[model samples]
Target: MEVHAHTHTPRKKWTHYFWEFLMLFLAVFCGFLAEYQLEHKIEKDKEKQYIHGLLEDLHEDTGTLSETINEFDGHLKRNDTLIKLLTSDAIKEHGSDLYYLGRRASRSVRLALHDFTIQQMKSSGGFRLIRNQKVSKAIIEYYNRTVFIDYLNGIESNESDEYRKMAIDIFHPVTFNGIVNPDNTIARPENNPPLLTYDSKTLLRLAGMVSYIRNTKQGLMKAEIEMKMAAIELIQLIKAEYHLN
Candidate 1:
């Protein structure tokens, strides 16, 4: 009987197994690297989007602040004239002017800041995406000042309200209504207008409120100016940092 000898298959070399292990390791490492790069790009893109939104809000804030500042400045000029009339014996002579100013004593010009982006960042933990420490701090400081201006705004409204309350005591509602034109401008009275009272103490007390209102406005102006400067600086800073237009 012829029997076939057992044939043995050759064992794989150590180098061949090493090459296979190396290939598997490289494939896994390459996939991990690709995933990491994708995540990094995503984070960077998200950061730019936040920055763009913030820039828009800031630009809007600057424009609004400018308008508010100018309006308040003009309003303060009128208050100065009002203070002049109310503090002197001349006020009785300028009855038309007195009632004209009195009607607008409580006019409040408010500035509602564009805070949409800032609020979103704060609420959603998006500030962390603003990686630069200096830029972040500047942004925070600019917004912080707005809060102070807002507080002052409340005081301004309160002062104006107090002045209006005083007006009720001394002002003639009919005369005030008569002075207003269709355009909300005040025309000089056709005849001498009369107030409710001529008591010096009461007149002076009403005059005192003008000073308070003026002081509040002055405070608001200073804060508004500071905030505007801050806004400008922040815009420049972010542009420089992020290379934004």
Candidate 2:
């Protein structure tokens, strides 16, 4: 019988086993670190994009606010003139001025905020990207003004509507139709227009309506100024914090 020699493989050393475990652990740790870094970079990129969009929105808001404010100014001045024409004793002689001022007074404007970035951030849960406490707070404050001013705008609309109704109550249909050209431009009658009513009470009631509209516009204009200031501060703060031009 041929005797086969018993050959046994040497057992792995304890240190060898430990080294193998260590290598695997290191590979997993490195992979975790790499993934974490990539996620961080992606978040940072998203943050940059959000800030850029917000900046654009804020600038547009500032411009719109400024223009709206000027429009309110014009509307208020014309309303004041309309009140004078309405209440004046010599109402028959003031037809041209009456038609011009009355038509202008009925016109109204409201602020349309440029809030696309803020809307996106709210919808997308992106407020987390605004890591700076000051920036976050300013953004909140600026948007809050929009909500408050919207309430004031509601009041403005109601007052303007009343004023317009008063106009229809007092002015003759022909005079009303004469003032508005086909293209909606004012065309004062060459002949002095006639009033449907000459009662003192009726004229005073219309004047009172004008006063209410003016009061609402006063509040709206003040709120707009405040919001515009907030927008400017927010813009500066964001630009400084992000080192953006």
Model 2 pairs in collision = none
lDDT of 1: 0.86
| RMSD (Cα, Å) of model 2 | 2.0
lDDT of each: 0.86, 0.85
Candidate number of the best lDDT: 1
Candidate 2 colliding pairs, count? 0
Q: What are the per-model C-alpha RMSD values against the true structure?
A: 3.2, 2.0
For candidate 2, write residues 37-128 as lDDT tens digits: 99999988998998999999999999999999998888788888888888888888987777777766656678898888889999999989
Superposed Cα deviation of residue 192, candidate 2 (Å):
2.0
Off by over 4 Å in 1: 1-25, 177-190
